[model samples]
Target: MEHPALHQAMLKSTFYPGEAGPVEFHETHISRLYLTHDHVYKLKKPVNFQFLDFTTLEKRHFYCNEELRLNQRLCSDTYLDVLEIRQDGDSFHLGAGSGEIIDYLLRMKRLPEGRMLSNLLTAADPTLPGEMERLGRHLAYWHRTQPPVGGDENADLERTRRNWDENLRQSAPLVENLLTADAQNRMREEVEHFLTEQAPLLRKRQSTGQVIDGHGDLHAEHICLTDPIRIYDCIEFNERFRLADRLADLAFLLMDLDYRGRRDLSAGVLQAYDETWGTDLDAPRLLRFYKSYRAWVRGKVLGFLAQDPEADAATRTDALARGRRYFSLALGYLCRRPSLILTCGLMGTGKSVLAAELATALGAIHLRSDELRKELAGLSPSSRDLSAFGEGLYHREATERTYRALADRAELHLAAGRTVIVDASFAEKGRRDDFRDLARRQQRPLAILWLNCPDELLLERLRQRRGDASDGRPELLAAQKRIFQPPCGESRVLPVDTRDEVAYNVQRIICHLANPEFLKEQP
Candidate 1:
């Protein structure tokens, strides 16, 4: 900033190599980026933070080379080299030409601006879902090839403890200013309990190479949807953040998508990722656990930006609001008290669809009665034996037994401080009453989302519902309608029309969860 002549020379196209039209300068919280016609140069700021040190020229050069090497693994064509800036008496040069070496710049080929993941997401492109599938497969193979750094279970667990402790310690000062004490308490308590209870499982993952070197910052802005998806800007100064559980990596992207209000894409991406790799990484509430961590990290960084002395007043104010938003997102992923959400209606009212969508949005456990009933009856979930209405596996006794098991699983998860969403056809009053009693005894809040549809729509849906876990048929609708005892006077019931968009319905459900009295209605 002091060298006005050097800065002016760098801005002109003449300073760059081979016909660069003009140079565009951009700055982030830690780095300065200069974009030429076909190439880009990045210079790290000489700033020392608690997590990273780039205060010395030597340290900056080391990290520049490190960034080049690490990023080349995923975006080989983009990362060219770490070039040196040299200086003479009263002038500075871009390349390794003469005089004394002043600084280092990570040079790269400029990628297409249109292909950036963040831009495409904002445009609401339909092809993004297929791109995400490809990206997931790419990440799966990339994950397999990563070098495992010290794959000792004990060491990994202890390191995890220290990392979490450091996060809590650093963010403690902004308890009331950035986030509420209740939100912080929930995060600290749930994280500790999860780490302690699932220590063996987590350590097993470490022993196997599921925990390895990963892209520390997997934000959408760092990804490009090229012929092969390119992910760049991995943390090079700190292996402590880069080396982590693979789920934590996925959690970063998932949390980023959620923060951007693209949970639909996040859900699809997870499905593809899980299908390509295994689902061993998906523990109960584990994604949310890691997601909360990722969101908190973003919030903490934003807090730093807000307090930066060099930042403008407008920039600081924007950072403060965005930081609080990130903290709120983190809080949404945690539960101070577990909740029991039941989805009950006739068979064809879109209960399963809503349940899955809601669970993905809230990171809650989704239990479907159809699957559980088949599991109990020792039948394949896809096997559809439409025995006479209310007979066979759908018999009164068998149905009650399945509901009891469903309730049992819900109770287990709720007891462990996790929210549960149970999808079932609560046509009989006794089953509904049983759940109400369970909620009462557990001392947890309850909400029965009673899905409703027109008779013709319900019949049409039942007729067209094929290859599903449900054995319901159009003929069974009349029987169900007759037996269905609507939650007419129940204070815990909320009627939901199943014809809405999943995203809108998810937001409605989230709002309802935050304030139960927001939209109470009898079914």
Candidate 2:
């Protein structure tokens, strides 16, 4: 359609006044789109395929209406309504009129594409870690509210199996023709093994209520980070595609992060989600499975592009190479597993310094109880006053509350498959017991390193300490020592004297954490 004609025709409509202006058209894989000042109008291409059908005008109109309805559930403000394009002589208008309607278009309020999370990340003007955390919490809340798909476990398994099977089957011909024999064989074997080995677990996820109708395409591009982080463009046409293991939805963003070389942000997102959701959820397995599935889906998309007759040789070759890279990345996830180490010690005894160094060495999450306590108390680490301990902050009765909150955060980081160095005084036997309990629950190894310093040295260090979150005044050191209860004989403790060189103390902690058996006889 000509832009001038469309613009002139749309201006006559009363649906959106002042919002309609010049129509800007763009083409994509599936839709012919037009953008106005405040709305986007998307018309489905009249293409017929086994996976999708928009050949007939009526079918196109129905799906257009369906798109508006389903998308409005999540993006109610953005998705305005559906409007049919009616033929008036040679040109078409955007409402019911005299001539036959040949096409349909879904109308929506246009949002600034620059506000997308992907664009924000690329620009790097604003940090999105906090926003991503909030987004994770929101998604968890949404998932909890969704109704579970009550069906037989085998049926759910079969549905997922068919989905994957069809996707792979469609992409196989292109892989065979385009990729080298070795690459094609590797892809086939890896994908087949992944599905075969993880089938039962996938079924278990559904039966255990881990599956839901989620945003099928959850890459950063589809997410807009305004005030509330609007997630739009959910898969509306296919229920089987959208109704999936929630991990699959999460993996899309993680895979995008990996592709963009932002593994740190990926780790942050996974940690936030696991923390908010309160479930172990077999994150490592889910990560691997979903990453591979996402890679395969990307490969399929690339293959489709390669098959397009209009695509030049260079474009096809580039698409095939990109597909191969994604497959290799999926395999990389399978081959590598990072080891974890948990550290424990008293506050202001050089534990934070040691933990920070080790975390840098191992690329781990340096989770400190001090930080968590402050966070739970609604105080920033830089805050000096005990204002965090007001009615909104810490209370005598809220001691356990703070500890549990800390433990919950620690659990999320641990579950996301990261080495966690927990720095805390661990002054009480119950606190140590709680950590031990967490270790047992997580089925991950734990190591406790006690930083021992002479009373004189501790006092000196405390006196020298300038500004820190611990808020341990020099005068309080003596009082803390008086009330301090060291780890009992039953508890695992690797004592390292802080008077020694910092590197030496850190090495000793690392050695003990790496070899718990050697430290078992120490205390």
lDDT (Cα, tens digit) per residue for candidate 1, span 1-523? 2345656777877877685586899977678888898988888888888889888899999999999999999999999998888789877777867779878889899999899999999999999988888877778778878877675687667777788888878777766666656556656776788799878877887887778789989989999999878899999989889888888888899899888877778877787778778776444457777888898898888887888889999999888877766776676675434678898898889999888767754667899999999999899999887688889888889987998899899989888877789899887677888887887777678888989878888888888887999998987778778878998877787888878644345545655665534323222
TM-score of the candidate numbered 2?
0.61
Model 1 lDDT, full chain set: 0.80
Estimate the TM-score of every prediction.
Answer: 0.67, 0.61
How well does model 2 score by local distance difference test?
0.68
Q: Which prediction has the highest lDDT against the true structure? A: 1
The Cα error of candidate 1 at residue 211, in Å, is 1.4
What's the TM for model 1? 0.67
Over 357-384, each residue of candidate 2 has an lDDT whose tens digit, in order, gives 5564344577776677778768798776
Best by TM-score: 1
